[model samples]
Target: MKDLSTFFVKDNLDEIVFSNRNKAYGAYALRNEYSSQLTKALFVGVAFFASVAVIPLIVSAFSSDVITDKGHDYGPYILDPVEEIPEIVKVTPASSVPVKVKTVESTIFTPVRDVKKNKPLPTEDDKKDAALSSETSAGEDTKLIVAPPAIKVGPPTVAPPYTPPAKVEDPNIVVDGTKVDVAADFKGGINAFREKVAQNFDTESVDKTGMVSGVITFVVEKDGSISNLKVTGSSSEFNSEAERTVKAIKTKWTPAQLKGKAVRSSFRMPISMKIE
Candidate 1:
């Protein structure tokens, strides 16, 4: 009891507050009690700083810089000894390589001039001479000269002396008319021919009909005289009358001419017996 009472009776303010020991034991004691916590906080800060510095190094070491899910999917791993990859080399073949071209000397093109109307073309002799000169300059192949085929000279045949065709009496001169420049004419014209025919018919007393009709055929000779008096018609009496009438014409006719020369020309006369 005595000890407990004495222990409770504490020292006064002068003894506790005004002590000579400057150190605050309360603060030192408080610090000592939380020392383990302080050491734990300090260790945490040091570990955080180390991770901040080393995390970037670790990320950079693993980063291939590929920016995609593919990069994220790749897990970190120890790298093998890094070696620089050699660049790919393309090899071109000798055939495909371009070659330096060589310049060639060639003749310039020349247009052919138009030939003038007054200028004549080169003759065969001139053409041969030019060809020979070109061949000599160009060292062309030897030319083969082919001789022309021989020309056989034949004698001109002499035509036999031209003999004119013989003049034969034209039996048709009394029938078919001849084409002449000047046609035959009566001595006094066509009226005279009819007058002579009428005069001869008036002398004929033989019986006749108005229906009786015939033609008298004759050829005027080159001498302007009538010949080959023939009769042609349906009625024989009328034919006979026409023939007698034509023969009665004593006047000579004007002969026809073929190319200014007199030619034998045929003549015809129709006769009708008028029975009034």
Candidate 2:
């Protein structure tokens, strides 16, 4: 009994130590085996893909061949030697056409007479006979008559010469107040005529837009009326209105005065139109 129990090792401790060592060794061996297998599979896959990629290129490098004389033995060939072509001879057909031309007959004509030749002239004896006949015919003429000369007349009388009056400078000739006509002494009364024009204007179409300006020249008589109405200038759009307005004025005008007497005179009027 001295030591049967001591000689018997502890069963649980021995089993625990053996189990841990076995587990560690088995895990390490499994990891080494998996690594070796994975490396081998990767090498095999890469070698297979590389061989597959190079196979077509290697085959293409040796497949192409250029043949010259032996190319015709195959089915069909292109760009063959030019000396093998056969020569072609051209044969022209003989022409069988016959040439034909039309012929026309000619006719000759002759003139009845030759007018260019010269003829003989009358002699001196024939001229002497003709002169004697003319003298005998002149001796049988009728009698002639003559008239006497008339008397001359004297120069006619002349009328008296006309004299033009002296020119006068009048202050009233310039347009001012009620003076609507140009006087004889006035050079140009455009400003005076314009004043009268303002009083004579009449609006026809007030609805119409824009405006028109026109100048009219006419003769003014003894009475206060207008005549010979004519539009000298006007806008194209208002030409009809200008003519109508001028013609509507009275035919008699208060004449311009010179030296305290009414006299015939010329006047001009300018018309303006304004629309609202």
Candidate 3:
């Protein structure tokens, strides 16, 4: 029989552990067979290029919507006399056009006094009673005498319709720094305002890649002069430019009026800087 010391011998341990370097352990061999260095590198390169290409496309799509600034009004173009449209001659009779003729309706209630066709003649007792009543004197203060109720004649003269006093807006009142009555307006209207901006503003530094919305708020003082100019928005890069554009408008505005008096008014104007 083999002894326990023989199984624990150093020679047996060396033969099992240090036999070969080429053949790996079971777990190591499985991992080395499945993994590939070239495959991993290819996957990483594709992901990097995909992310870089997608960014510029997103910017271009969003930039189109952002480039729009507040538009100008073109109300000064009036039609000439030659452009007037004359009235059309009726093809059919005037009666052919379906006219919704309104009918006048009046429902007046009138009391009717009817006389019986077959009234019976008065009896002898009724005749006697009528005679007795007629015989009574006008000066008599008898219990049987009853006076008829006095009736008011004709419709009471309709008193002049009560008119509420006109709503008087106080000029001093400022709602969100603005007057509710006659709002503030540029001297020559919106078109004139746009022309002034285009002629004066410096557009070289403005970016066209993305939309940067901002607001230029200013107070139109009582003397038809502008003051308190400010610029605010999400992008600070354009704030200085917006401030410069609004301040350049040296033209006096028509001051807002409330209660027939000029008042200091605040205006919030949106500034959209786009490459036109």
Over 196-263, each residue of candidate 3 has an lDDT whose tens digit, in order, gives 87677666656544667777787888877777788787766577766777677888888887667778
- Candidate 2 TM-score, C-alpha based: 0.25
- Candidate 1, residues 51-141: lDDT per residue as tens digits? 9999999998998776665545566788799899999999887676777999999999989999868656566755553444423243345
Tell me model 3's lDDT, rounded to 2 decimals: 0.70
Give all candidates' CA lDDT scores. Answer: 0.70, 0.57, 0.70
Q: What is the lDDT for 90 in model 1? A: 97
Estimate TM-scores for all models.
0.37, 0.25, 0.35
Candidate 1 structure, TM-score to reference: 0.37
The parts of candidate 1 lying over 4 Å away from their true place are 1-178
The residue-level lDDT of candidate 1 at 209 comes to 51
Candidate that beats the other on TM-score, 2 or 3, i.e. the better one: 3
Off by over 4 Å in 3: 1-178
Backbone clashes in model 3, listed as residue pairs = none
Candidate 2 stretches greater than 4 Å from native: 1-208, 250-252
